[model samples]
Target: MSVQLRHYFRLLSSTTMKSCRSNKLLANNFIIDFNGFYRNMSTVAEVVRPTDPNLPVEIMDVEEYRRMNGIECFGNSVADPIKTFDTYRWHPNLYRRIKEIGYQTTTPIQAQSLPIVFDKRDIVGIASSGSGKTLSFVLPALMRCMTSKQDLWPRCLILTPSRELTHQIEKVIKSFRFVRSICLYGGVSYEVQEMLLNKANPHIVISTPSRLETIFQKGITKLDNVDYVVVDEADLMLKSGQQSSFAHIMNNLPKKRQTLMFSATWPPSVQKLAEQYLDNYIRVNVSQTQSLSSLTVNKNIEQIVKVVKESEKEDKLLEVMNELVPSVTGFIKTIIFVRSKRTANRLVKFLKKESFPARAFHSSKHQEERDYIIREFRKGVIPILVATDVASRGLDFINVKFVINYDFPSQMEDYIHRIGRTGRYKETGKALTFFTAKNIYHKSNLIELLKETKQTIDKNLIDLTEESEDNIIKDDNNNNNDKDSGYESSGEGNDLDNDEDESSSSEWTSDDESTNKTKKL
Candidate 1:
């Protein structure tokens, strides 16, 4: 062994460990201890790189691999790309679990990112939501524990913005029978976290930055074993009110370890943040550059914008749900996003009074209540959920058939994320936004987003943007499309075939509209 490698192994023999700042991480805690790493990292004068025994021998050139996968990356170096989950040699149970999960093919992000991640290189992954970015880092982290020394109890740390996202990552990690994890966030119980730390002895620690800091400050947990760190939704972290916690955590980690940052949009704040802590990272961005607005809104989402007065929003929401909810049992999953906690509460009461079973979700709810509501919503126990922007981030659902913006979000980024709640995983869904006169200030941005997605702009929205809505046009043409093609295959019947809407609008077409309709959701 080289002098450097020999010296690193010496430190690994020590019994008691300090918190997290590492002088030599490769010898102490990096996930991979492959022979190629020793040769490539130690011998700078070597001419021809030896084949990686741990990876497949048939490595393609970098440019050709990028072209095949539709991946755009800028970096000093990259690893061999992956075509399927079987590309890497995984433990039999891990491979079996992936198959059981029914992932027949890798998404674009997954195919491009898994190889770089498995090579233990730093990465900044930018792709739309539902592009399978979670598993890109998650599978690699779990693989570390599956292959590591038996005493290295925790080998990875995952940080995200919200409590829901914390649990989501934990769920993915626990899919492996050998991988145990603890989830932590602010609103949850501290006693439960302490118990898990003392008892679970997990292989991964998934948390919000602030909560992880608290656990470490109390001296209950040590980061000495963490060689891999994943920052999921890195752009949202900048605004998650835990940037200081993130900085403190970064300052204390091993200097030579690997880091992965994933986000829906590649904002400058995130890029600058990545440069400070990440060393020689590769950036994997999808579709196009970050200058585009519709990065996260999938093409499968059929978007509808209806201009209604502020007072008419409640009625309009009920009407939309009535048209979309297919069965009499009312089991379709839908989410309505409001601007404030108060609005969310009021809307839930209104929805319940109007005979639509609903739940309210926001920051003010007790952590137990939030967890219960999310579970119920995800399992289809609750058919409709009225929530604030909190639900817009990383909360995954079974099948969100429709989304309604009872109030327009504060910025276009939030709008992109909110609409992304549906039409996930290449499945078709719908998003309907209630645009009132109060939201006239958002005219240009909304119109630009619609035009970029090739969606038809509402006539009322155009009038409002062209001048002002002093005399707002009452004619909204997008309503006709929804009237004809709604969940017909959902076991009840077609929404338009009902007697209620048959005599209502002169705008509604007769038998010709149903025959000529392009969509049959």
Candidate 2:
């Protein structure tokens, strides 16, 4: 057999034979038969056509492509724009898989980052959640395996922060059916994972950093042959305190391999991690603003904050839930986030008692239970999900119209991630945060974020800040001395009036009145 044909046969045989030791001779004989069959058919005419018949024939203009696709290319000598998957020159099987998945147009992140990744260059893609970041890396990894004519041994390693996300990525990879991939995470029997690794000999391994590190340390898996490493939601991984594991995993991998780091926000910690590992990596920012804080939350979301007494939280949440359900369109899919597992459980119990279909998701839950909850949530079987920060990072819950922060996050980064549960995939959604005086530390940051998003902020919430309090005292003193100051003597009347006007102008007029108005008058 020729060198190329021999290598192709070896790869095909390895993929077909799950057990390397027992089926070695069988795989060799099968490959030999396949090679003979291929040689017999080599005389036939080769047919080449576009992967998708509906694909445009001509290359789209660079400027027009950028505008149409919302692409922003940033790198040293970035490649030409890839308007569609067909233009990327992927293997025919991979192209067919893409078409089968019903993806005609590339998302902004996919359009810009795919070229750099396909070029085997490291990249840091800063795009919002549900912006198709998974496929941006998955496709390139699959294509890398497809073009190669060698037996695969976990050439691509994708590390995510959560098991939910790891499973999601594995699901997408499996959909292609061109490569073998396995999901590795905690809360499962290590022996099972080891068995699968030895038997499947997957081309790609999707896993959490800690679990993958454990598997590496146990000698069940090795990164010696890995050519591509992808860290999805890198910020979340670092925040979840997996930085050391991430570093250890990278340290063990071959230094010459391609690395792709993607996150909704590139905080300083994530940046430091990237600099330590990624060499001359291209940075792709899909957000309108270059600032990481502004890019953290999706601008498509409408953020609403309510400052209430601690005792009123439950009642307020019940009010919100009641309003969200029993509507003409049916109940809205919602995810309520809290800071701790205890809170999540308590909230779920209360919600259930209130006749809402609710479930609590946290690290304490078994992997199977969490997986089931996620699936049900995605299928819209459970409209209300109360979860901790564990659910914030990478799990894509489709059609989540509302995200409620029952407990304000300790950091602005967490707040951004919590709100990101909604407004995904460019869909307009609402994020309602229940703020209390106990969460004073996050008050200023929350106000700044609201202002940045151009959302109307409740003065009560903003005025609770020390700086705003000082301003309030100054205005009160001026009003007390001068009757014509316009600030009412009580001050509450003017503030209440302003709040009414703001709420009326911001929410009621724009949404409710426009949609429900009987007449223009």
Candidate 3:
């Protein structure tokens, strides 16, 4: 071994022997020992760790590779050519809005999707999260509406799977300043949604399927003038949530209207929805390696997974959280997703009792509560949010760096949405998930997805020991996990720390007995 390598081994030995940082011992039994530290100090070049003989090894010291190649941040100005709004030939009002929002250049998805929509062509855009996919459709929709004859009801309709996503899309659309748009979803007053829809007579409207279904049933005239239709998170719609609402809306839409579907992953359901609504649509996929590829993040955070017993999951999560707090000193923001609302609420309660500023979201949170929590989360008042499939789908919050999967989804696609909440908007984020023995069946499908994305799981993290193979069984099961049995194949973190005592933590108190049964917004 080189002298430098010998010195590093000595450092490792002292650290390990002192019992600092690492809670568990190294997997290999051999402890680093300094054999020749003084004489050959200048000769040491590289240090390598002993491999776990049983598991397959993947050597990916990306930082070292980058350094060796003299690659200093390739994604800076040199890699991406910037484009101004004037280059797109946008309307003056829309151009002003885009500039105001600091949108100097069009992202690849936006660049490709904008023109097709502007030309009145039906489109299917497949892009990774945070690729400015929303703006791609929103800009064209608003510009077209603002320039055209203003319809009393909305001329354009955007449908998102969750209330959070509906609100997010609406927020982006509303930035047009000159354009009028309304966001409709459950948990808020029907009168509120109705009044906004009626009084604003918005040129564009974004909503969830549930609320839109109600609007249509209540003789809302807005449905008739909606010449442009957008189905966001069509995969989520097809997977676990209600498809009837979308079907009803499609049945009611004017046959001549243009349609657009955008999603990170297009499973069979999205394809079916596209066939039902989109006509001769042009497809635009911007993900570098398709669905399973994770977007790049700043190298500060490291992602790893732990395989545990299903029954011990809660205990393991608690242990990991305690271990993470001190290691990551700052008040780091985190997002955690559980498979069911019951489990989500339970976890939130546990965190609250542990004195963590955490909240749970699902179909169960009332409109006002959901609204308050999401706003608080965005404002950083609530540092951590525990959620069900609703938060998993398409909610965008870029500052989130740490995400944890308390319960692995029965379907692998949901796993993608969960991790996607972090590592967004060109920022670095870390994700740690707990995969239990029960989830062993999903190993193959998940591995296939990773392979498709030209990526591989960290062998150190995934324990692929089970030999028995069984496919994930599909069921009619939706949100309640009580709705139907089997697997609703459709849709859809790290830690540091050691300051607070676990048993004495404070808990969040709620007085509202009325539950938000199917609240989406």
Candidate 4:
């Protein structure tokens, strides 16, 4: 046999063994039987498509993940089980809440992880974003807290990478009503979080890595009696800025606690951290065979790309908006993802100037404004939100029709979460991304992810690439596609324009000139 064929055969054999190993891990880690789900893994992995062609989108069995090693996923892996109350079978209150939320079925991550957590077992869940892994731990953690005596300040501590996700987890925990929870993050005042830490004596504490370090340093509360600890978005926590802060928090946690580490993607660093932090833990995977539609939203999204000259990007953004706004008003809400907070603010300001009702959400906004924007967006009063990657993971906004990557994501994993914001609740949606010649080199991972999803590249968006030149930009073609391509030309060597498509007035443009919009930054 040829070398390529031999490699393929070896890969297949390894996958079969890995599948068996993963099953054993789940059995050993969670005490659940999922052999029924894995019986047809060969057929399931063979069929890879972007969208699920049926109702109540079928969840992939979480057991099919055994094949993945390193950064590559050989087959579409199922997420860990996101166990519901029925999956627990012993928890009635959780069951009632599940019914109340209208969640009749358990997603794969929820199925695999929930039962293990409910059983008070330590676990490391390696599912992708939008895999319902939050609820997997939340349900069980809250259940454990509810059953335990409530005098402790926080019996369960959940750590996430970003401040936004801390708030999201707090919201989900509060929905339980049975569990009183508090969110602690750096951007918000430490005084307020400390106040809640004292008065609420919360059952759960949702916090970002830095804030947790501060709490430990300040001697705010003892971690001596903590029973459950969760590191949500753990992979991102391992990123440069957060690694030290997380290590400090890990050192402070009680040694005899049930530790859980959850992240969208499990990289080598995260795996190493798990070995150090998690004990006899189970690992679970639930990335879709394809796209975000398998999770909450963006499943029906027909992602299209628009490549434009760096000088003309702003104009193209507005043009895309002009064509999309009317339809978005009727069908679903929209979110535009920008690379920086300044850009987010600029885009929002530009849209408002054009009489489009839009809001900018990022770490820069005041706490009150941030809350207002999220509340307004959730209530459907505001249809469009311009945001940074801060909104990417763990924040669920239902009925979002389109997710536009005004800037391509920095990480391949982040692109998945960014687009995941739309096409929720079994509805169809669309994703549009603008790739300029300037950013193509910086965004190669994003390009690879797009190709994996089987997304199509519009000719208008394909900037030509030199074989050796990773950073490439295509020459602009002044094609007469539309009547109003009023893009501006910034004279910088890069030829990048901040705002050309949307008409700008002196009154609307802010005096501060920065790339990102977030005021706090």
Candidate 5:
């Protein structure tokens, strides 16, 4: 064997070898032809095909647009998502600033905003919470300021629903250092805000509607000179009982100005408001279909909406918690949102009975007790928190990885607002909402919202919409495709294959299973 191998090696070495520069075979000097090989390509990472077989008609006509094939847009002449962060080449600092802050890549909302905002086109953006929408309008507002900084008043006015949102926008603007901004809202001194507005002469004003209306009424600030206006979280402001105040502020602004509105969901009220202010403007949406308006979903949140009968909730919750928090000795921050104060109290007691560190929060609780609970929750002293709608908005949780909506909110808006609590600042978090037949009113809207987020639509949810309450939808699928359906539960297997279908779901999959097929991220 050694002698034969040596003879073959000698013959191979003596033979002359030739090969093409781009991945041509040279074995035995065969002169084999290889054309257009992988090595001949220019970019290894470039995607040459869209995700779907056919591009949507609106985007198919766009000759230059190529990226974000899944994102749907409405209105004529829809702008594409930002392909590059250097949208304004003249302002070199924007590029460096975004890179420094790790916004080198744009989210879906930011992508569509690039052309509309950078080109000074009026737009209505359906941007969800924690979607980096603040930066989208802030950067453009900054650019608008560069053209007219000589003014003694604001050139841009930003109106949001809550004080928290107002300050959130202020923080983004301050980080850019391109323009000065003043946040006027309740719980802060009006005298101090007026002093800043008069003395500092901010180029951009961020405020809750009521405060700004008061400031305008007081004759301390004027928006007549403002050429750029943004209403952040328009739907929230509409729902939060500030419609008249918002109208007053909008009426006060200059008539002929670039208007931009961003909202989580597109309610009729929001659409009407946009129609009244934003003329000839493009409405940008982030979804899979060409539906008129849909909710903007933070794709980072691993949202699991479980459709279960009201009777099975207790057993399901216990099983999910056991999987998520195996060792009850230490606490992991988890919030359980209930519909009423009584439910919150009962749920917290039940969770404690099950050996989980749980606390209750609602309007019924005293301010001091609520404050103490919030402090303990923040400190990680309590792992499970049961609260009413009162804790849904404005309560900031830094690391609450899991959120359980034990009961559906009265409306879809509240549901969106409640889930927004867990997935804060584009951070990854897990949220599970228990949907019973009582929430049949939300069937259509919930289905639409789930589609917007690209989440798996459980067959049970669809069935709930079609059938009466007597016909309870259960996961009894046992076909070969059950594994492929992406449905997991802690109740009887909606698809019933693993030990018990209810216990087989990968929904509450632990951190160790992140690399697996389940949607942990």
Candidate 6:
């Protein structure tokens, strides 16, 4: 036997003999002898300790065990934590790829979730956005593939909410280069995706639910061999009109497969979906409270809300842009979110006419146009983008300076997702909201959110309206006083023509509008 191997065997023998004789050697201290052996050997040697005959033996490094024990954990802290990539027996290629990507220390979510995933258990992980949740699952999935034999079909399937998110997961998977993977999403030709699937025969498939369902229905992709399934942005999938598609995909997958669900928030809809789909799953919540809003909402984002008339929103937006112009140096990357595609297109035209290079992204645009807009926006070619809720989810845009709500979102959850586009990766950002009477229904929710995030709430929004049952009399009197006057004006005109002549010049068809609407819940 080689010297290193001989040394390792001798060390193991000595440790085992010492433990048996003393009857006081703890599993924790038994690592000391192996630490020296590990440093001397170039290749990883599996050290198995069969403490129990009924349970499977785990092979881990002594240093890794110590680091994992040092990690802090929350919610169902029964599971062991993994603080670093080196703490577990990861595939060599996967380990090298992780280090290459400059990931040294594990984030709180990664530290806590990796151990549960490695144990081959169904897990529901609740962590904030930009908390490295992607790598938490990616590393475990790759390791599962690496420790097994290669298969002709994908052994892992990762489902995301949007095409952009599918592409993002695909990019992360590709970086490992150990397993072949393909990205499947809608808005692209099915023929191309089919051809790639047949040719690559990837071991991992990252896709959106709708596209994955289409492929599954056609019998082009099989899930019999898929032992690992990851559902990213689980709350969005369950609540955002994609629940049926998600259910269809889950039903087709193998019943014995390991499923992992990651989400920023966990509402009743998500909880119901989890109970239906997962079997005895372990819940790992890194956030202090069960509500994900308290965790995912970035405290660094500077939020400002202006109560403006509906017609003057464009003017107010322009004024805000002008104020930011002096402080911004080269390119001011901003995302302006509107309620409808019509407003997005109109805002784009108005901004362009005022010398701001802008683009519009919504479901109405062709797939290629949307792709181009996203690429150019990322490269700073188009600094301003007016979009609908399509861009509100988990797609990470780099260095977004500001997120402006041209039209306030009807749902409180949507408002969180919209601002989440900026202030990502721990970078400071700003969010400006243009609130009008149309959004008065969300005033209480907005006030609560602002207070939760420690943001300055406007006093005008604090006043209770007729919607509040307790203030019905006061609200009725206020409404009567307003009706008595010709119109209680906020010093802004209701007509779009009052702002500028450009309003008449721009004309759009109904096809250019987004039909997807979100309501307050």
**TM-score per candidate, chains pooled:** 0.75, 0.77, 0.70, 0.71, 0.66, 0.76
Using TM-score as the yardstick, the better of models 2 and 5 is: 2
Write one digit per residue (lDDT tens) for candidate 3, span 1-521: 64544555566557564564433223222222222111111211222222222322122233443344222221111111112333344566776666677886556666456646665778877766666778878877877787786545578899877667877887887666777888777656677767776688788888877778887798764477778888887877655455887888889888989898887776666766777677777766554343333221122233455765555667887887777632355446788777655566667778778877777766644555666888888888888888766777667786887888877765656676677787777676777877644456666555555565445475733555432113322352332233121122112211111111011112222522234333322
CA lDDT of each prediction against the hidden true structure: 0.69, 0.70, 0.61, 0.61, 0.64, 0.67
Report lDDT (Cα) of residue 305, candidate 4: 73
lDDT of 6 at 132: 78
Please rank every candidate by TM-score, starting with the best: 2, 6, 1, 4, 3, 5
lDDT of 5 by residue, 1-521 (tens): 44533443453345332333543433331222222111112111111112122431111212234334345556665543444453334355655676677765566677677667765688887755666667778888877786564765688898877655665578778887877888887654678877888888989988878878888899988777888899887776776677888889888777888999876678888888888888888877654233424455566678888887667888889988888854555766888877655566566667777888787765444333555677778888877788766566545678788888877765676677678777776688888988876567677777877776778888888887424344345544442223222222222223221110011131322112123332221
Distance (Å) between predicted and true CA of 489, model 1? 35
Candidate 2: pairs in clash: none
lDDT of 1: 0.69
TM-score between model 2 and native: 0.77
Candidate 6 lDDT tens digits, 397-422: 99898999887764666777788888
lDDT of 4 by residue, 90-154 (tens): 34675567678787666656656664565556777665545567887887777687667556657
Q: Pick by lDDT: which candidate is best?
A: 2
Better model by lDDT, 1 or 2? Answer: 2
- Model 5 misplaced stretches (Cα beyond 4 Å): 1-69, 76-81, 288-292, 298-303, 307-318, 325-333, 340-400, 420-429, 444-521
Per-residue lDDT of candidate 2, residues 49-121 (tens digit): 2344455333234555566654566667664445466654567787767777888777888877886777678
| Count of backbone collisions in candidate 5 | 11
